[model samples]
Target: MELKGKIAVITGASSGIGALTAHLLGQRGAIPVLLARSEDKLRAAAERITGEYGLYRCDVSNSGEVEETIAKIIAKYGRIDILLNNAGFGRFADFIEMPVEEFGEMMNVNYMGVVRCTKAAVPHMLERGRGQIVNVASMAGKIGTARSAAYTASKHAVLGFTNALRQELRYSGITVSAVNPGPIETEFFKLADPSGDYIKNVGGFMMTPQYVAERIVKLIEKDKEELDLPRLAAAGIRLYGLFPRLADKLTYKMLNRK
Candidate 1:
């Protein structure tokens, strides 16, 4: 619950939400381990932690890399108290037009990446009989969106996996939760759509990375099963789930009018 003295591992720590979360966790007295593909970025983030923090260069998409990095962490720190599966990528295009490789990459990082990291960390947590795992999903996980079929599906899988893991670990002191952010201003949009117009229009009401980081910290302390940000967007997702056809029409009108 309390973050003070906790050893937290945060993926996607190179920038954006992951970087902000690591800094905030450090401010709360938690020792953070920054993981990402960029060694330079990881070291910069670790340096800013102020508290005890380590940087590990890892491409979460690789199962072997994930396992080996986690093993090194365990060997060095003895145990991991919190695991934040935040590393992910997105490529937006119609399913028919999207490259198979792009979809595979998305799955590899967004969905399987979570699986690999969790697979490596859960056992250690179970052995200690206490720990927390937080998967950073998206509102897209709960509802479909245009030009993001692969991304949506990947996040949906993450949400399902988190739920199943939580149920399976109910008796253990280990807690599993998922945080679904609607549209935070991050590099994800630029990477997904170079033009950036689509994301800018849709995410006009975006929350800052710091805001999302604060919410993540709160969820860690509360051990909440799910955290959805920006009440409006969360409400829209629930509404869409209730009325699929109507939601589709409204979404088309709003999102496809460009």
Candidate 2:
């Protein structure tokens, strides 16, 4: 889809991939509607966009906030040509040791946040019969790793939802795509792995948020179905799927990196 003059709504736009994508979209003449929980950060992020952009303080985890924010966008912008579901977080902990509340929080913000935003915005897109939904999932969605069971499960739900939604909207002029990035240099690590071991272990393999953001912009322009960052890791995921037992034996040390 041509991004020129398009209306793109990006969740989690306070920073990282979401913020970078907003800037890229604005450069292409798209009206980026940036949403995030922090109004101050959103304000700062909006200033970074090349052209005019919309800023809304929204907590995606709250259904009411998400619905209200989308309504405001439609009322102000008239239509949503693109929806980028990038609002999510992760906490790396063993399932048994993880707090029950943390698990629930992951599902609420990471998985249900996508569901709520899509539900609120799709009807508007359906009215126009043209839109794109790009979900920012993770490589963890494709493979299980240690100390991130809750995070993995949430992203898995996102991929499942993205695939099914794509099939359902196959002929509706609404493209659904998923982005699975392995690791990135972002503030996410501050929250996901506070001790920083995970980032340290995977530092060499991490992609910059700029790189991932550029790929996402291209994905939307090309109308692709899904993307797995750092192609080598994508290859690893494929091998793991093909030979789970062998992969488990060979990657035991790496799997414990978290």
Candidate 3:
């Protein structure tokens, strides 16, 4: 698929993979529409883009903001050719110890955020009969891990939504895809795992945001159904699916690293 002149809207674009992906998209001739809660970060990110782009202060958790921002983008750009739902965060904690409010917040942002953005973008894509939607999920979505019950549940919801939505838009000329990557070197750990035990435990296996961003761009270009990063981790997910009991026994130590 040619990316030239495509209008791509990316959530969580203020930094991390979202920010880098916006820059990469621009390099491919796509007009990136950046959205995040931080207006200052958005402004800084926008200035760094090498080509055409749009910036919006949108909190995916708020329906009003998401709907309004999508409308504004369509109003200005004429249509949205790509929608990347990447606005999400994680906080690792035991189910009993985790705050109830934090659990709700995770669900609102990680899962419902994808829903809100996709819901708002679908109509416009349907009208044009063409577009692509990419939801950034995680490895936790595939295999449950210790000390990450809430975060895993939220990601699991994202995967469920992504699968159903993809089938729903099967012939709508719009492709829906999900990218599931393991831990990456980013500020995400600052909030997700404050003690940094998880990062230290799997430091060698961690990937960089730029590496994942490149794959995301490729996913959009190819319109792939799903992408699981860092081939080794993806294999583990598949193994767990095929042999749950054995996987649990073999991965006992690894899963508890967090």
What C-alpha lDDT do the candidate models reach, one value each?
A: 0.89, 0.93, 0.93
What is the C-alpha lDDT profile of model 2 across 122-192, one tens digit per residue? Answer: 99989899999999999999888888899999999999999999999999999999999999999999999
Candidate 3 lDDT over 1-258, as tens digits, reads: 799999999999999999999999999999999999999999998876888899999999999999999999999999999999999999988889988999999999999999999999999999999999999999889988899999999999999999998899999999999999999999999999999889999998899999999999998988898999899988888888999899988988977798
- Residues forming the 10-long window of minimal summed lDDT in candidate 3: 43-52
Model 1: lowest-lDDT 10 consecutive positions: 249-258
Candidate 3 accuracy as lDDT: 0.93
List model 1 lDDT by residue over 1-258, tens digit each.
888989999999999999999999999999999999999988877777776888899999888999999999999999999999999988788889988888888888999999999999999999999999999999889877788899989999999999999999999999999999977788887878788777668666678999999999999989888888877877887788799899888787574411
Error of 3 at 41 (Å): 0.5
The alpha-carbon lDDT assigned to residue 72 of candidate 3 equals 94
Clashing pairs in 2: none
Better of 1 and 2 by lDDT: 2
